[model samples]
Structures are given as structure tokens and as C-alpha cells.
Target: MTCKRALTAYPELLSRTVAAPSWVMPGTVRDNAIFLSGEVDEVGLCFFETAACLAYGENDLPEHLADLPLGWHVHLPGDLPWCDGGAEAAVPALRLMDKVAFLGAHRAVLHPPVGFADGAARLVAFVRAWEAAGRNPEDLCLENIRGEDLTGLWRTLCDLGCKVCLDMGHVLSYGQYGLLSLPGLSGRTSMLHANAPGPGGRHLSLDTLDGAGCGVGRAMCALLPDDAVVMVEVFDWEGVRRSLPLLETWFAAQR
Candidate 1:
């Protein structure tokens, strides 16, 4: 079945960092806002990199963002190893969530740490901390990462009453390794990180979808509810531009 959902573009679309030997200047939040003003329905901000900008008294840009008519979403930093750092990690995430709440963001996408041995317990503690702080658990979305055994992680999130941010590219990568069976997870999904997966887990433009990636993308779109949000998660302007049409076509076909 086809569902109607809001489409958003990642901030990387306005500007992104290039690798060594290449000097490509990234755009500021203001520049990005101006570029995407009339382009999409919402913008996905990377909190890991922009948290400093939202610190006390640095509200000029965020104030402008609040004035915009578009929706807002936050992507938490993946660098914080919640599983290993215990309270240390959870604290920062909580702080960021506070900022997300302040911005009135619809949701915040989060990633489980890389080597989370005690994933379940760690997540429980983290969620408890979030709850104690009076943050809305529904606004926190746990995303599936590459090469991780997300089954237990998913269960932990579900138990805590949190939602999911299904990253299509990561799912496709997992499927490649025969680890892609998530039966009831989609029902709890509130957002989607839309992108096509390439070799070595690279995020590619939706227009670059190979046969398998295309099928996965279509399946995801079909599964999401009408109120779900889809963020084009590619990292460059060209990729975002190319992916938008493909996403529109997919959404149209769904109807």
C-alpha cells in the first residue's frame, strides 16, 4: 500500500566535507537554510556537529530555524559509544535530546555504539536516564547500523517504548550478509534514512540504486505509515538532487 509522508533532505545537500587533497568548503547553517528554504518540506540537522551552535546564547541561527515554516529533525552523533561509556555516553545524548526538544524537532535519530557488548543493559540505563530527565521517549529513534546484530538492540528499544529510524541503505547491507529479517520492526518505525547502499556500505544516491537496493527502497516506502518521515540521507548536493526525483517517482508509484 502507498502511504503519504513528508520528504526531507539532509543538511549535507547544502555543503559537505571532501576527503584529503580536495578542498571543498562546507556551508554554514544559515547558508544551508537559505539553500533549502523552498526546496523541501523539512531539513535533517546533524547534532553531532552542530550542538555547539545551539549552546547557551548561540540562538541566532536556531532562532531563525525556528521561524522557518519547514519541519525539523535531528540526527545524533554516532561517535558517542553509549554501550561502553555508561553514564558518560548517556549524559551527552541526554543533553543533545534536550536541545532537540528545545528546537521542537519531530524526532532524533540515534545509532548504537560499534562494540556494544552489553547492549541491552546499556540501552535500558540510557532510556531510564532519558525518562528521568522528562524527555519524550517517542522522539528518540534508534537506527540500525552496518554489520551489527541489531536483533537484541531492536528488542531493547521496543521495550523502552522508543521508535525506530529505518535506514534503507543499512538494511540493504545487512541483507547482503543474510542478516536481514526484521518482522515487526517496521510498525514501530517513525522515520527513514533514505539512501541506496553501495559496496563497503557506502551511502549512494537513490538514483544509483542497483536492482537489490531498488527493491529494498520500494519495500521500505510501502511499509512506512502515512505519517512517517523520509530523509534523503545522501551526503552531497548532486546526490541529493538526483535522489529527490527518484524518491518522488517511488512515492508516486506507491499511490
Candidate 2:
């Protein structure tokens, strides 16, 4: 019963702040892909500081990533709160979505704001905007944050015909109250932010998972459809290198 899934690496593996090599500049997506060449199935493009690329009238994959065989998935900017300013707040994410579509991304993972007063309405409006722009709702996946009650948000997603990006570290850190164990949640998951919880609440390499954490990750993987995407959301190459084998071993055991 082994499932075949796409394995992706987060672009932050090129972050200079994480002690990246002297040649690798922080936030350079192309260099990051070059560094990760031949090591992953796909690349997770983080749109945190690349607004220029998403500027109006620009629509193409960055030069560095243009020729790579690895497929692209998007991590929308973390600060955009679609529920705050209505469509204006959502414009950045929507613009990024256009680029995502232009670049042929598998999915765009978004982090919705927690505790917004009009969360559901804002989400509906946002989805309407997506529809208005002729974008496919299936390309969007909402991720769970650390401390929010995403029940209403999940409902909104289901209503909009969208899917979920389940972050394993977030589940372990904030989902102990039972969301992970709930029925049907796993069935809707289209992506997994496959990382383990480490000191100071950071995402550790997958190989560092304790027995219980490993079991949780393994169970989560078992629930995903074979074509789902699993992004190793770690910050360093060592972590990425260590994680690939752990995930491979888990997938191998599933057979």
C-alpha cells in the first residue's frame, strides 16, 4: 500500500540567516534552486519578499527557476491577512496566485488570519475574487496556524471547494486538542508541511521526530491520496538531506 507522492523543499533552505554559505544570498530564489539541484522532486517558492516579481504586468517564473525540471508550489506571503481589509488585503495573495498560475504551480499554500471578526465573510469575498479572476479554486490550499480555532475557516474552505495543507509541526504544537484525530480532516488534505517540532517551537528535520511524532506523521501520510504533495519545510540543507530519507523510509514501509 505504498503511496507515491511529490516531495518538495522549502526555498528558505537558501536563507543566509540560517548560516547559508557565503555565496548564497538570502532571499535569492534562483540561487536556492541551483543549490538544491538534483536533490528534490519539487521546490516550494516562498513569496514573502518577492513583490517585485508579482508586480502588475509581470508574469513568468524567475530566471533561476525557469529551466528547472522540478515543479513549483507556492507559499504565499505570511503577512497577508485576507480577512482584514477585504479585497485589498487579499490583492497581494491574489496577485501571487496569478503568478502561481502563470508558473504552473501545483498549489498555493495560504495562512489565513486568526480571530478576525468577519473571517468567514472575508473568505467568501476572497474566493469570489478568485472566481472573478477566472482562477481555479482547487489550486488554493489553506494551512493551519499554531493557535487558532480553524473550524469556521475549514468550513469556509469546504464551501469554496478548496483543499487543506496540513502542517505536521503545527498539528503537533497546537492541534493536541483533537483536530488531527478528527475524521474527514485527513481526507481533505492535499499537502503536508512535513517537519517535526523542535526547540523553541521551530520546525526540525523530519528525521528528528520522536516515536510518537513519527507515528503521527506516518499516520497522516497514510491518509493522503497518492498524488498529494509533501513539502519538507525545513530551513537548512542538513535538515533537508536528513528528512528526505526519513520520508522515503516511511513511504517504503507503507508498501
Candidate 3:
């Protein structure tokens, strides 16, 4: 059954947006976006593979992306070279941004390279490169991936004026509870990737969260800013549909 309560009905959640991935269905990005418009506040245009998506965006993307009546954001390529390419790594990102500029995407989620030395300096270079291209640095949100959290780059993230996209699953699976306690981090968080880690570290529906996982989710929800975007990061449509009402319940409990 569909969620009986409209998300807007919850006063505490009215200011926040609930989103779904663009590939929730087997059809094209536009197809999924249109279908999800009725179900979510935003549709995340996932450009998971930079080269292929850039080609698709440049050649085959519909002219009516801007016409879609929902908020939009992009999940940038997970393979971006923030560790090695430094400032030059922003080239592909800039290209992708230009491709979807018409959509007026509110944010871009990035999976920063982990375990690299001078990670902060490298990220600074990337920010400067993005700013040099006339993009807003704050729109680039660095997400916490598995095995490594954002604590190492927290200072750099703040200094560069970038935002945070905290992945709830990463915090729970990786035991990154310390991130929740980081001073001033909550104020800078603009997005939340809401999911639970299933077997083999794959993302599962929010309804699949166990007691401990739910506790972690509650803590994560507590830190959400009024303007934050909560992405139900599960990939398939069934998982997403199951998660939406559960997310609503989670948000309602926060009141």
C-alpha cells in the first residue's frame, strides 16, 4: 500500500525533501523522473558512470529535463580522481554539470577517494577548480563511503565551503558514530543518503533496518537540517517504495 500520510502533513518534515534515485525503473532517466514525480519531492539524476552518462546526456538526453516538475540533483561519478588528478579532476565534473545545467540541480553528491595522503589539499584544489568554472562550491556534497568516513576530511570540507551528504548505512556498517558527534558538522550537512547495508554491503530498504540500525538512523535523522534532502538510496523501485513510508515514520518520530 502507498503511504497514507502525505509527507507534507508532518510539520517537522515539511521543510525537508524526500528523494528517490533516477534509475528506480528500467526505463530512461526521464521516464523514472516522471514516474517518481508523484511519489517524491525530488529525483536524483544519477550519473554513476561519468563517461557513459556524459555521452548519453550530450547526445540522447531529452530537451525537456528542465520541464520536469520536480527538484533535481546529481550523484556524480564515484570514480572521480580527487586523489591523483587534483584540480584537473574537476574537468569531468564540470562537463557533467554543464550537461545538466538546464535541470537546475540543487546539489551534487560525490564519493571522495579514500586513503590518499594530503586528501585535504587535493580536495581544496578540486574546489578551486570547480569555483573557477563558475560553479557553487557548496553544491558539491562529499558523501561518506564504506570503509572510510568523512572525519578525515571534515576540516577541509568546512574550509572549502562544501556540504556533507552523510550516508546513514556507512555510519552504521562502518561504526562511524563519532561522525554524528562532530562539532558543527550537522550545520553543514545538506543531504542524507538513507539506507541500510544488506549482505555483501549492498544497500537495503529502510524497512529492513534492525534495532541497532534504526537507532543509528534515528541519530542521523536528529542531525538533519530543516533544508536537507533525504535520499532513499536503495536502487530498485520495490525497495524504494517500501522505504518511503518507513522514512516518513522515521521523520514523524523526530517531532
Candidate 4:
């Protein structure tokens, strides 16, 4: 039976978004691009910058795009506002979430800061604010970090009854670094983050495929139920373009 209480999606994003994007309410051309990105390079730059519209104005957001799909989302920065103090963080975040809700987003995929003051505290404050705004714990999708001192954070979130947006590449890279692992996480996951790696020990530009993160990507899809939301977390569009085929294969191979 289809899960009604659970997130409604494409098997790719409800297959993934609308809830995530609706929070930001960018009203961009709603497309089923199950992807995410950053600025280290410039692969999915438009998508990144567009997602960053959370920090931008909302009036223009509704009027800018001609078509806003139902499920669109933005993976906000750990600092999110990335502007100033924690007290001010909630303002922009709330704005973003409202916009997402306005635009009909399905999820707001977020990662705690690379170096946070405290993981538990940060999550507590965030969730409290969401509750204050009348949002539920299920609305937020906290991601697993790839770097230092965060192995147990996932467990903490699991303990809190929050959803897990596990990143396969990070697990692999963390595993390679002896920092984290990929065990005991088979069924208790809500979504997956993926990317094939490239040179420079960096995630390949999602624009151009350099082929590094595929190992973990392949492994992650194999573990899931084949219809899980696997955001192709790339740097730019090149990475996004190249990774799609690989992801499709993963989707097709499911038993």
C-alpha cells in the first residue's frame, strides 16, 4: 500500500520535492531534478544559487517564474542564514520554510554546520522553532555529515524521531577516512544523497562527470527499496547531467 502519512513523492523525490521547495517558495520552473549542489566548484550553480533564494526576497519569487511545480525544495546551508548570530538565524529560515510551504515543497533537506557549537542543541533549537511555526518533525530532513565529529549525530537524530537523509558518498568518504560507517542504516532511512567523485579529492562538478562518487552511489541504491529519493548531490550542472544516467541505471536495476 502507498504511504499516505509518509511524504508524497515520485519515488525519485515524493520521488522527492515540493515539500522541500515549497518551504523556500522560489516558484522556479518546478522540475523533477533530484539534485543538490554547492559552490566549491560550479556544476549545479544555478540550482545552488536558486536554492539559495531562501535568503532572497519573496515577492519577486512568486512573480519571477512562470511555472512552479508542486514539489520543489532547496537544501539550505548549515548556518542557513549564514548571516549572523543564532537568534537571527530563525528569521530567514522561517521565511524560507514559509515560502516552501507557500510554493508547495515536500521536504527541506538540511545539514547541521560542519563545525557546530553543539549538534544536539542546534537540532533542538531548530525543531523548536519549526514547532513554534506549527511544522512537524517530519517536515525537516536532516542530512548526515561527511567530516569530523558527526558519526553519532545521525544516531542522535534517529533517537529524536527525526528523519534521516543519508549521503552515500559521504559515508564512503567518511569510511575511507575512518571517520564514519555505512552499517545499521539499511531501513531506517528517509532519503539518499549521491554523486560520483572526480579529481582533487573533491566531489566532481555535477556538470562534468569525473567519476569518483559512483562507488558509494551504486552501493546506496542497492541498499534501498529502488524507489527511494536519491538526490544526485553534485557541484554543478555537468555533474548533474552525467550522473543522471548512472542514477537511472540504479533505479532500473532494482528488484
lDDT of 4 by residue, 104-173 (tens): 5545666654556564666666667766777666656667665533455666666655665666556654
Q: Per-residue lDDT tens digits of candidate 3, residues 1-255?
A: 234133545544445688889988788887887677667788888888877888875324577766766788989997776656668778898888888878887579988766677767778888899889888889999998874588888887888899999998888788888888888988999999999888898889888988888878888888888899988898997897777666666777877
Candidate 1 positional error at 59, Å: 8.4
Question: How many backbone clashes can be found in candidate 3?
Answer: 0
Model 3, poorest ten-residue lDDT window? 1-10
lDDT of 2: 0.65
The alpha-carbon deviation from the true structure for residue 195 of candidate 2, after best TM-score superposition, in angstroms, is 0.7
Q: Could you tell me which 10 consecutive residues in candidate 1 have the lowest summed lDDT?
A: 16-25
Candidate 2 Cα misplacement greater than 4 A, ranges = 1-27, 49-61, 100-102
TM-score for all models, in order of appearance: 0.79, 0.80, 0.92, 0.64
Sorted by TM-score (best first), the order is: 3, 2, 1, 4
CA deviation > 4 Å runs, candidate 4 = 1-55, 58-60, 63-67, 81-88, 114-117, 148-150, 176-184, 199-202, 205-213, 225-227
Q: How would you encode candidate 1's per-residue C-alpha lDDT over 77-158 as one tens digit per residue?
A: 7767564555566677766656655557656787766665776777777777777877777878888886564676766677
Question: Which runs of model 3 end up more than 4 angstroms from their true locations?
Answer: 1-15, 57-60
Candidate No. with top lDDT = 3
Best by TM-score: 3
Residue 208 local lDDT, model 3:
93
Q: Assess candidate 1 and give its TM-score to the true structure.
A: 0.79
Better of 2 and 3 by TM-score: 3
Worst 10 residues of 2 by lDDT: 14-23
